[model samples]
Target: MQAFRHFKRVVTDWFLCGMFLATFLAWLFPRFGSSGGSMHAEYVINIGVFLVFFLHGINLSSEQIRHGLKNWRLHLMVQGFTFVVFPLLWLLGKSVLGTQIPALLMLGFLYLCALPSTISSSVALTGSAGGNVPAAILNASLSSVLGIFITPWLVSLVVGSGSDGIDLGATLLDLCALLLMPLVLGQLLRPWLGRFFARHKRYTNVMDKLVILLLVYAAFCNSMVSGMWQQQGSAVLLMALVGSGLLLALILWMTTRTARALKFSPADEIAAVFCASKKSLAAGAPMAALIFGAHPGLGLILLPIMIYHPLQLIVCSIMAEHYANRPAPQAADPALVSAR
Candidate 1:
C-alpha cells in the first residue's frame, strides 16, 4: 500500500513527463502505419477530460467555497488575471505572429488563454509552499466554472471567424454537456460522496492518471490521422515551443507583480499569482475538440500546453519550496502558522 502510494505520488507530480513520453512512443510506433488514429486520440482525450472534471467535482468542499467567498479580493485578482489579462496577451501575440502563424495555431493559443486556472496543482503547490491552500482551492474552482462561459465567448470573439464550420451555439451546448453538467452533478452529490472520495484518495489518483494518459494517446492519434505532424516543419515547431515558454514566463511574472502591487498578503499573493498564471491541458483538451472540430491537426497545436504544463510544475515546485522555507512574516495569521 505504501509503495503504491509513493508510485501514485510520483506519477501525479510528474504527469507532464508521462504525457510527453506517451505521445513520443505513440508517434514512434506509428500505429496502423502513418494513417494516424488522431480521431481515436480525440475521443479518448474528451472522455478523459470529462472524468478529470468529475473527480475534480468530487473533491470540492463547501467549506472551501465559503472561505473563498470571504477572500473576495484574492479571488478577483486571480480570476481577473486569468480571464482578462491573459486573453489580452494572446491578442497581442496574434498581432505579432500574424501570418507567420496558422489560424489553427492561433486559435489554440487563444484557447490556452481561455482555460480556467488549474485546481489540484495550484492548491498542491500552495500547500507545499505553506501558502493559503483554501484560497487556492476556491480561486481555482471558481476559475474553472467561470471559464465554461468566458472561454467560449472569448474564442468566438477572437478566433471564431478564422475557424471553418464552427457552430458557436452547438459548441456552447457541448461545453455544458462536457463540463458544467458533470460539475453540477458532482456538487449535488458531494454531501453523500465526500467521505468516500476522502477514503479512496489513492484510487482517485490512479483514475486521474489513467484518464490523462488515455487523453494524450487519443489526442496524438487524432493528430496522426489528420497528418498534423506532417503539416508543420521542425523549425516552426521549435519556434512554437520557445514562444509558449516565453508566454508562460511573462504571465507568471506579470501576475506576481500585480499581486504584490495590490497589497495582497503573502499567502494570498502566492495563491493568486500561481493560480492566475497557469493553464490546464486537462481542461483545455475537450474545449479544443469543440472549438477545432475535425481538424485533428489542431491537436498538434496543443503541443505547447503539453510542454508548458510540465515546465510550470517544475519551476513552481522550486518556487514553492523557496517560499515554504522562508522566515515567517510578522503579519502571518496564527491559524496559518498553526496549520503550517
Candidate 2:
C-alpha cells in the first residue's frame, strides 16, 4: 500500500513523466496516431479537444464569475500579467533568447506566455494553500473565457498571419466552433447538472488528463511523421527544458513581489500569484493544434507547455502546502474580497 501510494505521488508530482512515455509510445508506433498515417486518429483528436473545452465550461459557475468580478483588482492584475506583461517579457527578450533558442520553439513559448491562467489547477492550488478559493476560481475561469478571443489575437500579432500562416478569421471560426460554442452549451447545461458534476469532479479531471495525453500522443506522432524532430537536438531541448523552469520562476517572483507591493493579504497573495503565473496546458494543446497545425512543427511547439505544466504542478504543490500550514493572517478587507 505504501509503495502504491508513493507511485501515485510520484506520478502526480511529475505528471509530465507520462508525456515522455506518450512520446516514446508515439515514436514506437508513430504511424498509428499521425494525421496522415494509416489509422487516422485526427478525428479522435478533434473530438477530444471539443470534449475538453466543453467539460471546462460545465465546470465553471455563474456564481464563480460574480465572485471573480467582485475581486476586480486581483483579477485585473492577474489578467494584465497574463496578457500584457508576459507578452512584453517574451518580446523584449526575444532577440537574446532567439540566439539560444530556435525561433519556432520561442514562438511556442510566447504562445504559452500569452495563454490564460489554468482553471482547475489554479483553484485547486489556491484552496490547498488555504488561500482564496472563490477568487481563484473566478480569475482562472475569466482567464479562460477571455483567452478564447484574446489568445488568438495575441498569437496573430506575435506570429503574424503571413509568418505563422494564421488565417485569423478562419481560426476564430474554428475556435468558436470547437471551443466557444461547446463551452457556452456546457454552461447552459451546467445549471441543471452542476451539482452532479461537482460531486463527480474527479471524473472530469480524469477526462481532462486523458484528453491532454491524447493531444500529446497525437502531437508527438505528427512531429515524428513530419520529421521536424530532426530539427531539434537533445541539447536544444535540454535548454528549452531549463528555460521553461526559469520562465516560471521569473513570473512567480514577479507575482509575489507585485502582491507584496500591493499589500495583499496572504490569502489574496496566494490567489494572485498562482492565478497570474500559471499557463494552461489544457488550452495550449488544442490551441497549438489549431494555430500551428500538425505539420511543420506542432510537437516541437508543445515542448515548453508540456515541460511547464508538470513543473508548475510540482512547485506550486509545495508552495501550497507551505501556505496551508502557516497560520492565517487577519481577514483581508472584505472590500478586497480576495483582491486587495
Candidate 3:
C-alpha cells in the first residue's frame, strides 16, 4: 500500500511537470519542419478527443446529476461565469488589444473564452481542495453539453468570417462528433458499463490524460507545419501569454468573490471558482481546427489556451492545496454536512 501510494504521487507529479514542459516545448519549437506527419497527428487528436469525452461520460454518476439539479443555483452561477462572463471579458480584452493583436489571434482568444469548463482538472482540483467534487463534476460536464451550441454561436458573433476563415457549420459538426456523440453514447451505455468503469477509475484517468496530451502535441504540430509561428512573432505571443494569464487570474478572483457573496459554502465556492475560470484545451483544439480551417493563423490564435492551461492548473493546484489543508468550518447545516 505504501509503495502504491508513493508511485501514485510520483506519477501525479510527473504528469503535472510533463504538462508544463509540453507547453514550453510547444512554444519553443512551434514548428518541427516535418511534413506528412501533420495528418497523422490530426487523426490521432480526433480519436483522442472522442475517447476522452467517452471516458468523461463513464465517470459521471447519476447521483452527481441529481445533486446538480438540486443545487440549480450553483450550477447556473458556474455556467454563467463560464459561458457568459468570461467571453464578455475576452471581447473587452480584444478591444483593448486592438490591432496590436491579429484578428485571428483575437478570435482565438474569443473562441477559448467561449469553450466550456474542464472536467478532469476541475473535479480533481476541487477534490484536492476538499471542495464540492460532485458539483465540480456536474458543472463541468453540463458546461461541455452546453458548449455544443453556445460555443459555435458565440464564435459566430465574435469572430464572424474574417480572413482567418471561421467556419461555423463545420465546427458545429465537429463538436457534435467529437463531444456530443460520445457523451450521448456513454450515457446510453452507462447501465451496462458503469460498473466496469467504476472498477477501472484509475485507468480511465490515465486514458483521459494520455488523450489530452496527444491532442496537445497534434495541435502544436499542426501549427508548426502551417508555419504558424513565423507569422506571429515573439512579441505578440508574449503579450498573449501575459494577457491570458492576467485574464484567468482576474476571473478566478472575481468568481471566488461572487461565490462567497452569494453565501455558498467554501467547498462550493472552490468548485465554482475553479470550474468557472479555466478553459478546456482538449475541447478547444479540435474546435479550433474546424473553425479556423486551413488558416495557419490558428497557431497564433491558440496561443492563449496553450498558455492558460498550465497556468490555471498550477495556480489552482496551489489554491486546492490551501483549501485541503485548511481546518473545516462549523457546518452551516447538519444535513449539508452529512450529505457531503
Winning model by lDDT: 2
What's the ranking of the predictions by TM-score, best on top? 2, 1, 3
* Per-residue lDDT of candidate 3, residues 1-340 (tens digit): 5444534554477555665665566666545412245346556666877887787777778787677667777898999999999888987887777668777677768878898888888988888888888888889888878988788888888657445545667777788988888988888788899899989989987877766565555556557667666676778877878888888889988998899899998888888888998898767766666665545565566778877876787778777777788887665898887899
Q: What pairs collide in candidate 1?
A: 36-225, 37-221, 38-221, 38-222, 39-222, 41-218, 41-219, 42-218
Question: Candidate 2 lDDT, tens digit per residue, 52-73?
Answer: 7788778788886776577778
lDDT of each: 0.75, 0.83, 0.76
Better TM-score candidate (1, 3): 1
> What would the TM-scores of all predictions be?
0.85, 0.90, 0.83
Q: What total of clashing residue pairs does each candidate reach?
A: 8, 0, 0
Candidate 3 runs further than 4 Å off: 1-39, 161-165, 330-340
Candidate 1's TM-score = 0.85
Error of 3 at 328 (Å): 3.5
Model 1, residue 199: distance off in Å is: 1.3
| Reference-based lDDT, residue 163, model 3 | 54
Rank candidates, lDDT, best first.
2, 3, 1
